[model samples]
Target: MNIPTRSAIFLSLLFHRTVLSLQPPAPRAIVVGAGPVGIAASLVLASRHGYDVTLLESSPETSIQTKYDPTKAFLYNVNARGQTLTKMFPNLHDKLVKRSVESKGFADATITVVPADPNLPIPKSSKLEKSFEMRNNENNEAGNAMPKSEKAVGVGYWIPRHEMVGLMVECIDEHNEKGEGGKISFYTGKECTSVSPRDVGGVFVEVYQADLVVGADGMNSKVRECLSHPRSAVGGWSLDCPKPNYFKLKKWRSPASFLRIKVLQLPPQFEIPDAEGNPPLITNSENIYAIRSIYKGPRNYLSLGLLPMKNNTAVRATNIVTRPDHEVWKLKDGNAIQTWFEKAFPRMNFNGMISNEEWDRFARAEGTRFPHCQYSRGMAVWDENGDSGVALVGDAIHAFPPDIGQGVNAGLMDVVCLDRALSGLDTVTGKEAKSAKENDKPSLGKNLARYQKQHSPEIASLIRLARFGAPYQYRQPHRADRILRTLWTLNVAMRLILNKITFNLVPPTCIILSQRPELTFRQVMRKADLTTLFLKVVVFGLIGLRFRPRLEILSMLKP
Candidate 1:
């Protein structure tokens, strides 16, 4: 007789167990905040890792309560890194696409660089490439032309935060209905007071005690603080240990429509071809450049962000400061927001055309009420060396500026890395010998440290790149560097450099190979020789091109 299939055996075992026993034990996890990072983390742990997760949100409702919320104003571009993580969770990407616009081209449509001086006799540069673009406008056609191919820079999807949240919640609900081994319970209108570790080496979080705690609380994290290190306790790891700074002081506003303005110079390296099909020559050495402000139009708007660098005083002037009782400025109500924009920006001949009503609709649709800013600028990971089973992921650990739209993506990467580490340890400990022993393998401590050590350098590098990535026309020195930096910033050039540097410097694959040296001779040869040869070729090409104009000429020669 043939043995039963794995699924059939599993189903038979499940049916034979008592109805109550069929349900998995509640593997408690308390998530502090219900924001994107928190929700995403909770879902991953609960759905993928078979952990019982509960998400806590301070708000009474799952949806955005405020009308003129600044958080809702902008759309998130889910890049390749983020999509890779979402793919781990079934149907997440499809759900997100249903609610948002996906694009693979740049929003600006054309790349143009301006000169440092308005009177300087410099030609403007415009180069068209396949760039990603997305808008929060509901009326927007799904796929619009932007003078380039969709596959030029890889796939990118644009979805509003609210819509993204809804999709995640739906996934959680669907998984729960199937009575899967794990579940994600949502708690609204609850605040976490503290987290403390039990004697048995599990985390205990205090909310309203009667409530379930699957600690996914956010940055002012009570769960992280209480469980890792209680305030009153003296010996164990303390949560009060300084949290990592992940953001800087920056504020952004939404414009009712795309504004067209003339500036002296273009933000660095953003060169555009002139009407004569020639690269616009750069003259001014300073970094100050200009661009025609392209505002989001009609009932939709583009966001205006303010990020202040250390010692950058000019950022203060551009901060969105509104009076307490301005006639047009009501902080939370969307209907009243347009009036504020009209009064504050007042459409003049120099300013682009945008109406108050249009601004209000866009603000309401995008959920733009509160001001958006980051207090820290990078990711933080804390590991308690002893018995305390504690770890952090997502924004709590690696927060970056939204300029590159990698916030969600980075967080997803953290989840994948952490999950893999946990799985690896389980396999080694013989915990995977049977199904019952799998979930019983408690606490990921050393594995977490390893994960942090492995991921931090790359995360830090991304933070640095984002910090210096975009060329700012407002700064004099940056404007000058833009031209020299342009090629490096482009998607094609950046990928080449990133591959070379990450592969050579980090050698993640090499590290993995060294750990698992049981490969075939041919396989080892490919990894050791072929990979190195490929990298050498790329490095040589990059270095050789610096002294020669052949590649540039070839590119220009292409139709």
Candidate 2:
């Protein structure tokens, strides 16, 4: 093929410009937060829908982390549910999988059980010692072997929060360079001080006005606060009481807010001595190691969960969790903290793993309190004219502990659900006519309302699930309580196995069967309730049957 002449190229450019000039202006959206959810939202809104998206972040450009940041180094396991969003863009999904450390359930994990109270006598007759021995024997026999059937379930790729955000930004930049979709303008150091419904139509984010506003700025969201508590925003004055144009979001905070977590930076390729001759540290970054301990007779306990970092250069980030009244919180100085660590984890070499600077940093860190799992009642709001719209996604609407590791996954699913609503997929079936014609622009108010209706119940269910379906681990202190929890878990597991073995009459536990793509959060909760009911019925029926013979004998003897 020959190259086109300059005149021909100029004419072609002129014709394209003329066509573009005749088209209607694109809708605009303002997304608050440059984090993973916000960036993904910007990509979808701009690319899928014809919207000029503006992404705003409070932090400066230079301040945004590109690597392992100790202060904000939280490990996120992007589960299969969350992967649905990334799969929307094949390139983005590939990039994420390439950078993340893949985990195939506990088959790749290690559990190191160290006694918190070293002085306490753990005889062979004790359950604790027996458990240790059993675990050791299993390790010796199987060598990190998991049941073949359980391999595919609960598969997630791990990535640091900031790194994942960085990858998202990079993808958006590449997409913008290609000029493939609608335009996106990203602004840094832009903090959203307030949000208000526009007088004519649309919403306002500080000085910038847009047709829609998305609040993904996290748990303490200004947009959520302003919209939900308008009276407080107006300084105790209520101007639009009778005909309030905005929707009010009411939230219920769960009671599980007592847990707290602190990040401890440790050296890579470190090993702890085990009874099986100090097995080399699994350097593939696939296995998670939990350094756990039992309750130290009347004293509080601190547990360490080590999330794998990339084997080579990245430092390991160990999450230490405890209650506010735990003994670890009372340590005043760095030396005290270091000594405490040495005493608490005698197996692991804390002195060699943590540097003096890291110890000082750990000592100064106040640690993050696990926020109560809360969900908003009304997540979407629009003006009376049905032109302006606002929606809450991610932590802004539902904030909870990371016990379930659904923080990022649930947030991403929220975006996907919103996308489905906007596309009219929720209402219209294949080849079925939509409520609006093909040429008609999507209704912001109607779609947002649809999203609210579809997503609210799921959010409520997720919050409830996070509150109760969470595993105890060491959240419970007493030995008897731990034993009860273990028995209950085993009972549930056995019931599920029996169900599978039979015709599947009994429902599975929400905690174990949550990651199945087919089951939504609401379905998970319902199944868990069903399983509990089934168990209760079985127990009481057995009890009545066992006492029936005794009752009959006593009746015959007595008048």
RMSD of each: 15.7, 6.4
TM-score of each: 0.52, 0.81
Query: Which tens-of-lDDT digit does each residue in 343-438 have in candidate 2?
Result: 766655677767888888898888888887777766777666556678888888888887677899999988888777777657212122255557
| Candidate 2 stretches greater than 4 Å from native | 1-20, 107-154, 230-256, 273-284, 292-300, 427-442, 478-502, 536-559
Each candidate structure's count of clashing pairs? 64, 0
The clash number for model 2 is 0
lDDT of 2: 0.71
Which ranges of candidate 1 are over 4 A from the true structure? Answer: 1-24, 65-71, 105-153, 208-388, 425-443, 471-559
Quantify all predictions' global Cα lDDT against the true fold.
0.44, 0.71
lDDT of residue 444 for candidate 1: 49
Predicted candidate 1 versus true structure: per-residue lDDT over 66-173, tens digit per residue: 222343334466766577667777688787666554554442223333322233333333333321122102224222212232122456666655657767877778
